[model samples]
Target: MDLHQLTIHQARDLLRKKEISSVELTKAVLARIESVENRVKAVVTLSAERALEDAGKADKALASGENGYLRGIPCLIKDNMCTRGLRTTCSSKMLENFIPPYNATVVEKLEARGMVLLGKTNMDEFAMGSSTENSAFFPTHNPWDIERVPGGSSGGSAAAVAADEAIYTLGSDTGGSIRQPAGFCNVVGLKPTYGRVSRFGLVAFASSLDQIGPLTKDVRDCALVLNAIAGYDPRDSTSVDCPVPDYTQALVPDLKGLRLGVPKEYFVEGMQTEIRDSIHAAIKKLEELGAEIDWDVSLPSTRFALSVYYIIAPSEASANLARYDGVKYGFSYENASSIWDALEKTRQFGFGPEVKRRIMLGTYALSAGYYDAYYLKAQKVRTLIRREFDEAFKKYDALITPTSPTVPFKIGEKADDPMQMYLSDVCTLPVNIAGIPGLSVPAGLPGGLPAGMQILGKHFSEETLLRIGYAYEQATEWHRQKPPLN
Candidate 1:
């Protein structure tokens, strides 16, 4: 068997039947990483030793007839999530050496289920940019085409799954970090409703907008991961105290009577012809699968989402990242004459250009003179955007749109163009702003590159979104297509 291509569910069944031990699976994954990590640049801190140790434990437990869906499965984690005793660099020099004393709640949940942690995947510096090129260390290349960028800041996690470096991986999405990359890489990525999963151990990019989610090979694995991690945590003040339903139950292959809406604003002018056609075909497929589509849904504020996200996300980021000065942990400046000088010097040297750019933009937005004109107004507009989604959901079970406006672009294509970079997440940012769930599933490879179709649902409505997504996935073969990495 080509162990590298097995999904989480496939591996779980094999482990349960003792067809393959976790140790052998872990080794297979590690071997694959060793073979491809150089070209993909998907991993940041590899924990081969730790992974083997955990796999050994899983094997012993499985032999004793104890097994769960994720038990003995090898998985990769995005670097931004703190992993106890392991380096959790957010792909930046700022936290390059920072080791947390405890694991994030999601990590703890997965570990409890006996899931093996492979290693931390690369990401944009502090999860700020749309392309993985913003990493202070190195940019992660798309597994599909090494010359193109893997969409980011969760690019490494998505690329890892797309390249079969790991079965599935966890990624944090703030302003489409997870979905955008998943689209570019041709995998399944889910950004659960805000507060649906704990953010306790996740490094904050934009606190209000940031969310942790799963990027997987298939929708079933996506739901399996969600089952383990979606819940409220007292550690996260923003966590909603709600029950997490069994997401696997939403995997029904039939979508009869389901209502889907396509906002007129999402299919904007100048959208790439290939992407536009692919999404339209996906909608037609859903309709053929018994879904009713509404074409007149409108979100007038859609055009302003990019502008609003830049303002609100950076403003929160400016506040949250202030803790990274040269005081407690992380890198510190040695030749500083005073405390203030040390703080200034550390950030100036440690933060990447994208990080610095956001901080400056945020600081200026929240500054007293411009607070009302920029930050406050943006918040008001955010409320309107959220309200529009709320109203739309009342009439539609889910909303459909293209995950990205275009397929993956060549590396450095948008690196020097910040506006173009920000626009990459235009279709995805509103879901975050509305605090709703969104899933990116492969639609087709138009122009010989993957394009993603996004499904948006009401708050805590991941099940509905998954149900619709699974039906579409069953009827299509896009998810089965793999990048020609080998």
Candidate 2:
């Protein structure tokens, strides 16, 4: 059997039936990683020994009749997530050698479900940039075209899955980190509601907007992974105390009368012509598959979403990153004569340019005179954005939009211009601000690069988002296309 091509669900079923051992599947993925990782640069650290050990244990447990949805499945986690004894770098030199004493909540949950940890994938340092170029270590290349970047800061996770280096991978989305990269890589990525997945161990970029989610080859695989990771945690104050739904079971819902709202604002003048056409084609396909498409509705607040996200995310980032000063943990410079000088030099050397830029921007935004004008006003705008989504959800089952404005760009194409890079996330930032669930499923490749259609649902309505994506994916062949790596 070609273990490398099996979805998490398929691999799990095979494991349960004794058709294949978890060790075999894990080894197959490790071998693939060894073959393509040099050119793709997807993985920062490979946990081959640990993954085989875990898979062996999982195989033994299954032999003894223990089972779960993700049992014995091999997967990767974004470097930002803490894994006990494993280097969780967050793609920064600051924590290059830092190993957490405990596993993150999501890590513990996935491990409990018997999922094998393959390794930690690379990402933007502190999850600060749109392209993986900001990673202190290295930039992840798109599997479809090595010259292009797999959209980031979760680029490595998306690229790894797209390149078939792993079964699936986890990513954190602050502003389109998960969905955008998934689009660029031609995979299924979902950003659950802000508090749907606990953020306890996720390295904070923006407290209110950050969310941990999955990047998989298929919608069903995404559901299986989501089932394992979604839940409330008391350790994270922002985690909602809402009930977790059976996401896998939700994938089979009937779409006959489902109302899918397509906001006119998403298909504006700035969007690439091909992306607009591709999204419309996907909508037509969904309509043919029994979903009702609602046309051209206004989402005025969405226009302001990008600006608001920049202000809020950076502002929170400045505060959250304050602890990294040469004090307690992470990288520190001891050569400086004074402690303050040491702290400054450590941060200066540790953080990348994009991170430092945001830190400065955020610090200024939240400073004494600018707080009410910038941060407070942005918060008010956020409420307006949320209200717009709430009003739309009241009339529709979900909102459909282009996951990104254009297909994946060449590496270093937008890396030099930060504002241009920020605009890449225009369509996705609104959902983050609204604190709603959004799913990005491969629509098709236009101009040879992958494009995805974004589906947004009401707060904590991940079940609805997954159901819609599943139904759409079932009728499309785009997700089956593999990037040429041979």
Q: Write candidate 2's Cα lDDT for 1-486 as tens digits.
A: 478888988888888889899999999999999899988999999999999999999999999999897888888999999999999999999999999999999999999988799999999999987779999998999999999989999999999999888999999999999999999999999999988899888898999899999999999999888888888899998888888877888887358889989999998678899999999999998888788888977899888998899999999999999989867779999799898899899999989899999999999999999999999999999999999999998999998999999999888898789899999999999989988989999998987789999999998888888888998888888999999887
Tens-digit lDDT string for candidate 1 (1-486)? 689889999999888888999999999999999999999999999999999999999999999988799988899999999899999999999998999999999999999999899999999999998889988889999999999999999999999999999999999999999999999999999999999999999988898999999999999999999999999999999999998899998899988989999998888786798999999999999999999999789999999899899999999999999999878999898999998999999999999899999999999999989999999999999999999999998999999999999999999999998998998899999999989999999999986699999999999999999998899999999999988887
The lDDT leader among the candidates is 1
lDDT by candidate, in order shown: 0.94, 0.91
Instruction: Give model 2 RMSD, 1 decimal.
Output: 1.0
The residue pairs that clash in candidate 2, if any, are: none
Candidate 2's C-alpha runs over 4 A off are: none
TM-score for candidate 1, please give it: 0.99
